[model samples]
Target: MTAPVAFPVVTISDDLALATACARWRTCPAIALDTEFERVRTFWPKLALIQLCDGEYVALIDPLTISNWTPFAELLRDPNVVKVMHAAGEDLEAFLGGCGEVPAPLFDTQTALALIGKGVSLGYGAAVQLYFGITLAKDMARTDWLMRPLSDDQLRYAVADVTYLLPIWQDCAQALQQRQLADWHREDSEFAARRLQQQEPAEFLYRKLKAAFVLRGQQLAVARELCAWRETEARNHNIPRGHLLKDESLLLVAQKMPRNWPALSVLETLHPRALRVHGQAILNAVERGLNCPQAQWPAPVRRLLDVPNGKAAQDAMVAAVAAFASTRGIPAELVFSRRVLENLLLAIVDGQPYPPPMWQGWRRAAVQSALASELTSFGIALPDWW
Candidate 1:
């Protein structure tokens, strides 16, 4: 049986209450922060509530009632105050959308756990249970946070987010200090926070589409144009990009380079709503792509599995990273993910920059030697700087 714990909940509704809470929080050296939002059908997350705890004080600040964010924004920008969170990616997004800024000097418990060799992708509940032997109820996870007058269970769940986080932050900070990886955690947390706020340029977005590797030359250009148009349309309407047109349908259209409605109608994956709403716009994008100069065409993206000897090199690097991580007490996934290795391989094949930031900083000392040895064995030479 799980032991019941007391959480003194205080609701900050108006601007004055929120400002007062921020004033108190600014004095604390470290505080736990979390946000509840809804984003199921929209391009951006809808900010619902902000939860905060500083060991002794717990408060839920309702964004619906607060207008003046001057005090809270100052608290976020305060250098002395360290904001701690768990799996802060989406929460960071919520903060950016809500207040046009994100917390710096962030200490993400999930990232800290991975650096300590515990695990990557450790959810808050798992971390709490792992460290405190407490199983939290997740029944309120899917509740409508934007609704007026939230239920008791909803408010309790919100408080619980930051309540256990305070202790988890303490434990994680201690572990990081003991392992001498506090700087690494700080660097990664800042990078992740910044990355969450970045909007990838639409022109380059097609490179991330599924099966983009299959399209080349004019076909690739078409895919790029189509994706760029979809991105603009989605953002303009505040709907999901996928809801406008699925990737497979876009890819199919790109492959065929359809010029007319009849030609586009043959694509079974293209939804009827898209055809009725934006059919001519899609054809115009296709025409523009067809008329694009040869020099403007995007190069085909190559996957390691599709390229000769690429898979072997990737496997060697993966093994090297795993072996190095095992000895250094760092999670291998944290050291280098599959996507990172793929990007590294493409850079090497294209004779582009040898080492991206993934191979720099603390990671350079951890896995560089082993990875370099693997590449040399495969007859690949690193850039002079590498």
Candidate 2:
């Protein structure tokens, strides 16, 4: 094991200190960034701490003390400086919640690694070990960042996140350039940053449920209303959705369209406490759904298996995509995950337009060229623009 290097750690609890750091950060071409937050029980992550490194300086900014996040948020939005992070999905969410803005012109080291064929979804610690042969301790990973008076171990863990990130990003950036994958990495990293910051509309939330396809017409409308209500309540209470009402219970209520308290009370999956408290609200949601116009009801969702030849076509397309990615030394999922491909397949089968973003830029050529023969065999033709 390599001896640990000591980087200066400065804590910024006040606005001036943070502003000073931001001034320095503005001059840098790129900076490593990471966040520590508590999200186990809450719908929104409680921002606890922010860490940053720019090859020379390391700073731990206490989010609890800083009232003004403008400086930091501006730095994140700066077009000149690239914000670097590893596996930045959750961190992007944290930034949106904590700083009111996500980093633009982002460089995600994990995505870069996948582009360079290092590994898919390699974690921060593993990447540190891979690039620098330093095995980081995991003891402080689960420490409470919201607590005042953080322990030395906790501080070390937070600092270490950004400490090694800049170097890993440099290596990945170099490798991406060598492989002519810089454009691909940039597209993916920016997409990831934008994607995570988006909030899924509550009315459309039921579409995300796996069992939603089983319901149709009015039942689907009821499910959508219940889902939207649950989403709103969860956010208002700042509690996890399942903590209030489990999905199964919601689905059952939608399916039953229970009218009276006794009817709603019969669902075994519905918790006793929830029934006692939100029973009327749930019933009201059901009433609203039932009164909804038939034209406004959500269209029935068909199971993939219900579609003729859907299974075989999905399987063949998956194999073709995998084979195409392998030949180019790219992670297949990076192009399109199995779940995404399934959705795309379903959309096509329904005569809907292909998702515009997925078929743009480098991905368009990759997918079209890769699946040309397979698509032809299936009697499917991609749009000429693709």
Candidate 3:
């Protein structure tokens, strides 16, 4: 058996040390990277720790100690070197949001592992344990990486994360190549690279409350107006959107169209302060809902799918996809999961072109074929289903 490699923990304390570490990383062909951040109470994540390993050496950059970030940021933007991270979504967000750039030529080990049927969305600790039989210590997860005079144990744990990652990636990459699934890894990496721009408006700000769809056009108009008001209030206050008004409360207010402060005050879901401060505006919204013309109301909610047999056709397609996933030793959720499969089924029944399956390789093929047949049965032919 190959002896385990010991990782040297280098804390970047000066500009020279930081630059030297980046220079080493820039020359290396690929490096494993990870970050620690706190985001519980803030709009943006507070980056506390950054860990990088270039096969031979592991360097832990303490953000609290070093202020000059230009050297590290330049290395991050370098496209020649591949950056590897396990489950890199939030880390990528922090990097882009902080330094205004994301690393190019990025490889996500978790995605690569899933492509070869290792496990869907596997945790970093689990992946390392499975491949190396080395159980990683978890005590440093909630440690204050932002504090100075870091303990020896915390430094060792941080270094170990990326040090062992190099070997784990090599093993996983080899397995993927043997299975002819290397292209899947490439495509997934590309997909994750694009995730830096796919931010969506929060659902609470846009989606109508559950069962709010049952209301008439005028009621929906009221709901939309109230939602717009609440969204603006939440932003101006710099509080969570729900802190201003819950979706259910907004729906009820729109439905009832209360004519007076007393009537609105009776709403159980309304926050006491919201009623005290904006009760007049709430009444105005209710009045607008009551008087808005039918033609001016928001459009009706469209059904997701319109197949000939609807639910029956959806059931058949789902079963087919699930069976195909099982036969390949991959989890059915990794293929389409129940939620995405249901949406896809609805789109096919509605005569809409199927959306790209999130999974790669044979699983995507299985989902596409099943969806295509369902669409054809509804007299909708999709030539690009392949």
Cα lDDT computed for each candidate against the true fold = 0.84, 0.82, 0.71
lDDT, residue 146, model 1 = 96
- List TM-scores for all candidates, in order: 0.90, 0.89, 0.75
lDDT of 2 at 345: 68
Candidate 2: tens digits of C-alpha lDDT, residues 78-142: 99999999988888888887788989889999889888887888988888888788889998878
Tens digit per residue, CA lDDT, model 3, 214-247: 6667777787777777666654554555666667
User: For model 1, how does the per-residue alpha-carbon lDDT over 1-386 read when each residue is reduced to its tens digit?
Assistant: 23226667788889888887888888899989999999988877878999988878688889998898888888887889999999998888788778867897799999988888677899999888887787788999998999989999998788888888777777789989999989999888878776676666777778778789889899989998999999998877878888878888899999999999999988766679878888999999999899999998887777777666888999988898889878878878888987788778766764543355466677777777888898888888787657
Candidate structures ordered by TM-score, highest first: 1, 2, 3
What TM-score number comes out for model 3?
0.75
Choose the strongest candidate by lDDT: 1
At residue 258, candidate 2 shows an lDDT of 91
lDDT of candidate 1 at residue 100, scale 0 to 100: 68
